[model samples]
Target: MSRKILRATYAPQPQGQLTMSEHRAAVKAVCVFPAGVYWGQSYGPRIVSGSNDGSLLIWDPETGVTNRIGQHEDLVNSVCIMPGARDRAPRIVSANRYHSVRVWCERTEGDWEWELVGQHKHFVLSVCVLPAADGEAPRIVSGTWDNKVLVWIKQLDGVWKSELVGIHEEDVRSVCVLPAAGSEAPRIVSASNDKTVRAWREQTEGVWESELVGIHEEDVHSVCVLLAAGSEAPRIISASNDKTVRAWRERGDDGWESELVGQHENLVRSVCVLPGAGGEAPRIVSGHDDHTVRVWRERGEDGWESELAGQHEHWINGVCVLPGAGGGVPRIVSGSEDKTVRVWREEAEGGWETGLARKHEDVVLSVCVLPAVGDGAPWIVSGHGDHSVRVWRERSESGWESMLVGQHEDVVSSVCVLPAADGEVPRIVSGTWDNKVLVWIKQLDRVWKSELVGIHEEDVRSVCVLPAAGSEAPRIVSASDEGMVLVWRAQSEGVWKSEVAGEHASRVSSVCVLPAVGDGAPRIISASNDETVRAWRERGDDGWESELVGQHESWVRSVCVLPGAGGEAPRIVSGSLDKTVRVWCEEQRKGWEEQICLQLDSSVSSLASYEHYILIAQGNQTVRVWLPDEDPEGQHMLWIKVPASPCDAIWNIDPQAGKLRKPEIIVGTSRGLATFTIEELPF
Candidate 1:
């Protein structure tokens, strides 16, 4: 028998930190949303997601890309594709705020053409296409905010027509059709905000009739139907705002009986059934409002005992299986109220083991891993509430060692290492809650040289190292709680000279340097609690003048510069507490055109970008990586999970250093530090 273990990157929270006062309590709590929702194939090459942004996207499980589709006008609420249909092209349908469902055909020439389908009387919220039956034309069932279920059938002339099949007192939220069981006609199940599930069955003569399955006592938000193997009866699972999932089965004599799958602690929102694979028992996946999704499977032969398969943080909004993608293992994809979509696959071994565990004095705010240089092992540097900085090193294959501790006197808010300066050993710089900045350098031995402090008068919030400018030594810039930006340049062998100070109306939250452009003056960009980003350049005369780059509806938490593509001006990317990542490109004449690159339904805590990928870390302990060109219109690039109880600050992804030779992500948590390597992740 194989052992099942959890392998997570864990860090221990620091001990002995001054507790935050009552007034600071409200300021410390954080809320996060899902990075983005994805929809795609159930197998190998899937369609990860399409959006209201008006674009369709295709995805390859091995590599992920963003902007996979082009654009849309309103919020895209739903998508569906007809499988194994005629014309060798899948019929795709999408719903939006306009109460319209548009259909598109994939042409043999590999292009997509869109056509307006029938319009709903109100906001079309969801849509699902049913499998064709008895050589009959395929059908589409859609639920609308108008509280009605609309069924569309293809006419003998090859055109489609719609009719109202059932009505509820409140909004109809979802609809799904059950596969045929035995000789019975297929059935359709609909969930509504009125707190009930309605089953519509095809009669002997092919006419549809509705019956109420009085299972849920609150708004029934989602419903799915499952057919058990070797069993003639089909099961109906419904999720409701009442915080429970109920499974109902139709008996041979025409009566329905239900049971509770009491796992979720909040409103159950979505449910999906996983068909048996390789003779294994079938399983059920459900999403809830309490920010969790529970997977349940039958335990024994009698099917009387049910056990949890797994759980995910955040309200699970949707779940589906990739038909042929997981090497016959069957994969499950889930969406959540947290604004993220996660893909889970069972390991060949029973399960994964949890990673490392550590602690912090205050919330371990920000974490970064220094790039590994030839033969040098990577190191994780963390800043915490105790106003201190600590360094953790991965010493061996399975061991982590603490190398340095206590570098600040107040909560250390940020940490970053400067790029190496001409053979000079790189130095570590930190910003603290005490409004001071500290720089550390290696001495004759491995001991840290005397810490240089007092660079700022207010709490230091963030720190960044600007790339080299001309022949000038690289400079370290720090953002502070006092809404100031302070620049320090290396003065002597080990000391830094404060060269400039600039101000804003609110606390500076994040800072980065724009990549140089053809002799252009190096510019420093900073995002603030003021909801604006300001760009500053060192004037040839030595004074700093500031220009407003753009504005966000909420606080901008992190900013990164995507390396230039083909000599194009480097794009500046920012993540905001407003639940969006905006990309700004400079126009030769217009200052900056802010393009809403991605709208993460959640607050984005941190962001990192390489030449090929952009990574966003959220408050939910998850990271999203996106490749720019695969699909221009899709929302998700790829979703990656972090260790438990994650921080609300910037984390680092060191794609270059790791035992597996693939990019490794280093995360700082409230407890300790952990590393996520590509080899450990399902590609």
Candidate 2:
């Protein structure tokens, strides 16, 4: 028998009840095919580089193996490692010639992936990760050709937000953060095309003030900071297009004085400080248009002396000092127009060895399932609060394995599997708090890829896929916190068009596609904070229209549809904050009306229906299975308490695919995923 292979790219985590701190230990470096390198930074024993080819590579210095792990739309211009919270993996910041600046975090149980964080009105020229103190939140500084500098801080909720910190008279070329001094606020320095270097001090919380540090005869191209040691104060270093590099120090009179560091034969394009090792004097490494990297050592009273460390085949654009571990000699990595990143390291005998620097949810917000192919087991896909989407499947020999499949800029709020007939490739749709909906489809090559399909005015609360009607292609329906619902139809592969389908009096909380009764037009079901459950169908000339079918005293938080069995009409199932689950059915003469109402002790968080069973997830840590038509009076079938508050739930095909297999219900709690079997429930 032939089996389908599902290939996906993105972030992921496993199913279990892992504490917040325990989750941090789950991250591991993954291997991939190698790619070229461009902008680079050294993290621990590994080197991470962003490429002009729009890929991010991680290089193992010992094995000389490079792996491509991430990608961008444009050439990566700058890359820096952000100091993470104490005991956490440091995050990476990268910029491209485009307005995009992305923050890549090593995801727990997954690869190092990026989420786009900030954008400028013009190209982002430089990015600097701020020096974060223990327990301090991570922050970043970016310089843009828009003549502005932005400061991004990771907020308490784990979102990175940007604020305008300063504006230059001309294009800001480079930015650097000064080492933290005692309890002082962060200090940022920037070099600009206006031929001036400026320093910004956070005089007040979130407010900045700038002062002129120094000026050059030509545009300043790069800047770096030397941390203060003993009696020596921290100093600012700037390189200019005028073939000069200057070191500036704050004078006792609050003025700044610049010392001539070095004069180059060509423009000094990049500069970085290499700290002294074993009581050695600190040195500065500068890359120049003269096609050489020069190392300048401060010779006490004799001034600074420079020597050519390495030469590139073309003009150099950026350089970074890779501090060796265990007192190993520091290495200089430079990116040049030569399309190479060369690493210059000091040999044991003292001469330099130049070589090609090898590269390099807390919530399961949503849960879905891909039916087993041939002899294979079904696959479970989930979205989490950590901004990742993961696909999990079981193997006969290895048990289960998972791959990170998608990532969003914010919390993923909902996920749905598109309607697919047996033997057809299944597709997944996800909605996120970032106000966007993305579609993941398995390609002809069997690789699963995602494309942004639509955007909402506010947080996307829920998403569902409408099956094709006659000749129409399947559509994506999404509900948002702003009370609007949108239906998206594919215009072409990887392209989509959307139209407003309906609106609610308040936030539309959940949406689900209803199975067609016969050859009738497809229908959609939606629940909202407006305290109502609504059904919508296309009316030809009237477009799409909605009719109120069910109501509760409080916000309707979740909705699902039960396909008709026997000769019965389909039923709309809704769960509400009023602690009730209501079932609606269409009558012969009357419109849709409530047929069953089951009261519970706590508010309902989510709802999922399959066959004759309705899974009701509650924030009180309980998942109650209700069989509405089981007996004369609807009765509870099973009650399973979870480890944490339930956020969402879904009924999926048994992943185990046993001899006597049965469908299962997967619950997404605040922490992770939990699955339950109900095959043996007494009738």
* Among all candidates shown, the one with the greatest lDDT: 2
- Encode model 1's per-residue lDDT on 207-271: one tens digit a residue: 66888776577888778876766745678888788877788877756667887755455777777
Report the Cα lDDT for candidate 1. Answer: 0.64
Residue 148 displacement (Å), model 2: 0.5
TM-scores of the candidates in the order shown = 0.48, 0.48
lDDT of 2 by residue, 138-216 (tens): 6788999889999988777767788889999999999988766667766899999999999898877779999999999
Name the lDDT of candidate 2. 0.74
User: lDDT per prediction?
Assistant: 0.64, 0.74
What TM-score does prediction 1 earn? 0.48
